[model samples]
Target: MTAAVVTGLGVTAPNGLGTEEFWKATLAGESGLGPVTRFDAAQYPSRIAGEVTGYAAEEHIPSRLMPQTDHMTRLALTAADWALADAGIDTGELPEYGIGVVTSASGGAVEFGQRELQNLWSKGKEYVSAYQSFAWFYAVNTGQISIRHKLRGPSGVLLTEQAGGIDAIGHARRHIRKGFPAVIAGGVDAAICPWGWVPQIASGLMSTVDDPARAYLPFAAEASGYVPGEGGAILLLEDAESAAGRGAEHIYGEIAGYAAT
Candidate 1:
């Protein structure tokens, strides 16, 4: 049996954009929490959020394509592009044998939610955008990602709560065992829409703190739920032999054993 290996990886975590940048901030214990700039919180009870800083959509993807997609899809596509390029798995010439994509997310099409609600509340029924019907669906990220890469091989999505993101990779590995030669698998999230966040206020999970460090306390003394977070990590998984043949570098780890019980 061929061992599953990670040849290339990318992430858009709350800590930062890019693997290096995220890692640097993470190891240094840097916090990304701040006032919610994406929305005017004069009415909302909680004002703090974990916003992604310094990530320009144009920098990650082309200008023309960015407008047509949601923030989460943009994030996943950008990371997937970088990961494939890093793996040197040039699909431009590869004959269609079998490839796959698996990804996950906690919330979907948040901005779509925000816009539609705003349009309805502020401008009444006539101003609603037509795209809202499909954009807010849970499957948008996987669909957009697969379409962009032309990876029509095989696709699946995991939405197992917060654990869904971690489980998506294992699903990809299973596909490889089932005969897929290559699989792009990972997950992402962008559930910070102000309208969508209205439920959180009732749920009583968010922080009311204005100070950054004191705002979001996940598992510490404060431990009053957690601040919403966004972004994702992707891994390129191929048979160990195939990865070595392609000369991909820096094998991260192996999916040797997993448990759910």
Candidate 2:
């Protein structure tokens, strides 16, 4: 039997941008929820949300990619980069076909799609950028990460909403069992913009409480609903034998088993 183990982790959450920062803040009982600031949510029923702060895309992403990706995809790419670095894997020396990417997304790229459509309606069809053809796709994150890292093994994306991230990891574990050495798997999502908010609001599952602290009491009887947030995590899943062969310094844990209905 083959074992899939977690070698590295990267996190981009509203509370923090990296794994260390997020962990420290979480242990300190800090929260990132607040009134929406990406746009004016003044007229919306639910105004507060978990928004990633202190991230300037220019600092993390190449200037050439700036015009080709959405905010969510950029975050995904950054997470994947961090995960690989954390694992101490020098992708340049590894076999391209030995690595793969599997990620999940729910909202796709609402902000990018909305902007393109607005351009189409207000200006002309030609005003829309060619990148829109894939920027709004749910699989864009997986594709972009794979391309950026030069990973050429099996790749895919899942869309099970909140469950998608875990599902992606499960799938990646299967890939590892099937002989692949390493796989980048996880999920990152962003849909806090006006266009994205409309559908979420229509779902009737968002908490309407104005107070950031009280808006997301999921386990309490006072729980109205859940608060919408952006960002997530990415992980490096490697076959146990391969990890040992590569002199991996740490093993977070093994994906010993998985089951879902």
Candidate 3:
């Protein structure tokens, strides 16, 4: 039987830019939750969030592609790049059609959508860019990542909210079982903008507590709600046999089993 194993991991989280930083913070029980800064959250019920900081998009992405991509897409792209590097599998040496991308995105690109809408209303339709059409779509990450990497295999996007990331990996495992060499699967989300906040606020699930430490107590009875966060993770899923053949190091545990109803 074929098997899928995690060879590399890349992360862009509110706490850290890459896996190393994120792991250190996580191990120390440090919280990334803080007062929102991307925009003024003064009026919102939930004024705090786990926003990614110190990320320089230009450092990870080419300037030509920057303007066309939204923040979430940038996170996804960067994470994927890091994941590929960590795996030691160079795309330049791989078969294009053998590599695949499967990702999950819940909010799409709220900031981009919001800005485009504002342009449409204030500056007329002519002000909007052509990329606006798909920049904010939920499936944009998978499409963009696939194109950037020249991956022509079984690519797809999952939309199961928080569960989507895990679902993406499961799907990739199935794809590998069916004969694809490998798949990049993960999730990225950056929906803290005005438009995004409004919908989240409407859900009534966000924490309104002003105190960052006491704001999100999910396990306690005093748990009012949870703080919102933005970021994503990317993982390289290669079959066990192929990974061993290529001398890939499995630092993380292999996917022993997967099931979804």
In terms of TM-score, the best-performing candidate is 2
- Say what the RMSD of model 2 is: 0.9
Clash counts for all predictions = 0, 0, 0
Off by over 4 Å in 1: 93-97, 120-130
What's the C-alpha lDDT at position 82 in model 2?
89
- For every model shown, what is its TM-score relative to the native structure? 0.89, 0.98, 0.97
- Candidate 1 has what TM-score? 0.89
Would you list the clashing residue pairs of candidate 1? none
Give per-residue CA lDDT, model 1, range 1-261, as digits (tens): 767877778888878888888889999998878778877876888877777767788887777666556787888888888778777787654446466788888778788777778889999988877667766766777777777777877788878767877698888888777766778888887877775578777888677777778777666896656677778888888877776776767677777855563
lDDT of 3 by residue, 1-261 (tens): 898889889999998889999999999998889998988988888898889999999999999998889999999999999998899987666676888999998889888989999999999999998899999998999999999989998999989887889999999999999987789999999998889998889999888998889998999999988788899799999988888888885547677778888
Model 3 error, position 44 (Å): 1.4
- Predictions ranked by TM-score, top down? 2, 3, 1
Error of 2 at 167 (Å): 0.8
Worst 10 residues of 3 by lDDT: 249-258
After superposition, which runs of candidate 2 have C-alpha atoms over 4 Å from their true positions? Answer: none
Tell me the tens digit of each residue's lDDT in model 2 across 132-163.
99999989999999989899999999999889
